[model samples]
Target: MFKLIIMCLKSRSNKSGVRCYQNRPSSISRSDGRRSRFGFVGGDIGDQNMWRSRPRQIHINRFPPSSKVDLRAALPKAVQGSKGEWAVDEGPTLRWGIAPVSLMADDFAAALSVLPEQHHRIVSCVAAYQSHALAFAERHQVENVYTSFEDLAKCPNVDVVYISPLNPQHSELCHLMLNHDKHVLCEKPLCMTEEQVTKLLEKARARGLFLMEGMWPRCVPAYHYLRHQILRNRLGELQNVRCSLGLPVSQGRLGLYGGVTSDFGVYGMQLALWVFREVPRSLKVSGRVNSEHVDIAADIELCFTRGKRAFIEVSAERKLSNQAIIQGKNGTIKMNNYWCPTRLITEEVDFEFPLPGGDQVPPTHYHNRLGMCYEAEEVRNCILKGSNESDDFSHNESLLLANLMDTIHAELGVGEIADRKQIPDLQRQIEKVQDIVEDPEELASETCRVVQDVSSGTLETKQQEEEAPPRSKAIDAP
Candidate 1:
């Protein structure tokens, strides 16, 4: 049986804004699949129409939306150079530069910090506020280190930059790099607003430069495997998506970062968008706010057409399951540590009442930049091909995600950390897209239509089931 709960806020007089809270639902027993006594009373289950699982089964041969593009096919094969090391056919070998000493930057460099000539060459390093860049460069034996942004930007040989600076500085640095004809792979939550993202995209396009958000999750091997399986349609029509992610944060940073929404919410949002490849028609969000008036926890409900929906929860105070569950008519796919999926569990057989354990499996781990290398490889390919946007993480996808964050920030009453009025064009552009954002029901319907269109065979199966006589039992016991 399918169940849904929508929670929203009502204005309660307070300086911060209205805070919404609902009593937690009682835990339902797994073995019996019985509704708990603490929650709302159960309704009639005798009616087959209300309880029967949808009969749509996506054919395995057809490609689902997840696997529509090949992320690695754009690059040509490596060839022998005068140095006898592998090199691309294009002109001189690509040179890389690292910037701004930060944990994210450190992680990137660590992957490339191996023995010289081991893989790609990152020849330049620069850090603004931290002295560790020199140490990092020395340890890695990098030849040049620039203290000023100007020197790094002006360097003629530096082909690309892996930018993971403070969130607020992303716009300024991205513009600087693009203007200098340098390709960029900026970290996720690229900028605070869609206006900034659009401007950066246009700038990169005009300059003929490669630019991509470092959403490492999209490039990993496990997700690649998941997408491949999804494309084969083993699960049937995706009816629901559930994502939960959380991380413990210092109290001071919690309010400034706007808690889980800005931090882990994007992962949830990204997963949902990837599944449907459409904007949600409508969304309802309610969450707790810290004393600083920033959201620390949020429960988000996204409605898509054809009665499809997603429930996503994000929190900053404690660790979460950090998993994403994609449920279809026939089976379910569970991704552990979904943000960086090292493991994936798929249950392809008929989904029984007490979901069978045999169908579920444990996650298998892989070692590839902890999976960050996949995104790095994508950046390298984009740079080599002279492409402005990635096939996997497209410019439109970035804009949609930015706009979605804007909506969340405004709704949650944690406006931009930096004022938008400083950039009048951005403010105006953001205002323009607000009206076009789909209502929840509209988004749902649009997604459902896409699902139906792609899974035509599944629709036929549903039709066949409708013509057949009803089954005697609601759910058969194992």
Candidate 2:
């Protein structure tokens, strides 16, 4: 299933480097998220396994190692506010090259234009569609357009690779690029499973390539503003912090997703990971996962330093909620859904703290900076200055968030399922059924007749069908 094909460059060849391409077993079917029923070559299907309806299979790329390097030595340590757990360094322009990533072309185009000094520009992009990549490259004046990731690594002029592949595709793509000696900037929830993340991080460290999870929230400039305001100590000792962000889940678009956590919980987990001023000094979190999968919608409470607390609630079940409230011993600041507070309300000794303006008005100096715009600036600044990861979201914290989410799912009575029983059919004696993925044609097929095999009068069931192999749960004090 896996192999390493080594490539070599000739001493006098005009080509700068060797490119590796491993055609996947099957091409990803590009349609409205539909599964492809590729010509199922009838092989020796196990007598038992063949009876089961097949789930969609994902195509994957295999890579060969042409070269290797020790990655830990190349990292740099720079910014400091929360403390120095990560050593991010500062240096000069890194001729940046991106691969396997693209988002709203206009946003990325403008950001690249705003960047002051990046040595070289080369990128290989993948989107849901090729036209999307073409439009972005044409609009942004980027010369290269690569449809596949392997071709991107082969580009002679790349330094750093950006990975924004579809969620499941991330871990492997990241390793492929890092192996090619390029720094990486990858989008959040980089990989769904914890094992994938740990391996990616370990590989990045081993290769000495800069790798960061692109959790844009951490890069927003408002963080600087928020940090200064809090450290200014104007609000007195911070007592409790609460933040919530919710949007109408378009069931039409998101409902069929089947994975509930993908929508609502991903937002809260990402925000709660970064927004709070301090992580739990001692944290205990628990929540529930739907029977469907780890598609969870849950609440978490974090007890922080000095009796303070942080509460985070998320659910795919609702449509609208956008409020961040930071309450102090004396006053409270209510932030609009995803933005900094349009108004700050302070209190004193169980009474409202006096305002500079009228009762409904805030001080004359509140600013509303475009958030996403600022995130791009942060990425540019970090790359140009040679900082490896976003301080707001260090490489380590991203993994921690995934682990916490998993822990929360387990601690709660999430995996609970009731017993199943056979339903005797009026026409045929009996049948048993559990939830419900049916195709109209398949419903009429002989496959439906197999339901009688489980007609045992006594009900028997198993909990937690199976999960990927476990990861090392090495928890350090938060």
**Top-lDDT candidate index:** 1
TM, every model: 0.64, 0.55
TM-score of 2: 0.55
Model 1 lowest lDDT segment of ten: 426-435
Over 403-433, each residue of candidate 1 has an lDDT whose tens digit, in order, gives 6676566567765433232111111111111
Candidate 1 residue spans exceeding 4 A from truth: 1-92, 113-119, 255-258, 348-369, 416-478
- Which stretches of candidate 2 lie above 4 Å from their native place? 1-106, 117-123, 127-129, 250-291, 294-296, 339-373, 380-387, 411-478
What is candidate 2's lDDT per residue for 267-300, written digit by digit as tens?
Answer: 4555443334333333455544445444445666
Backbone clash count for every predicted candidate, in the order shown? 9, 13
lDDT of 1 at 91: 34
How accurate locally is residue 31 in candidate 1, as Cα lDDT from 0 to 100? 30
The 0-to-1 C-alpha lDDT of every candidate, in the order given, reads 0.55, 0.42
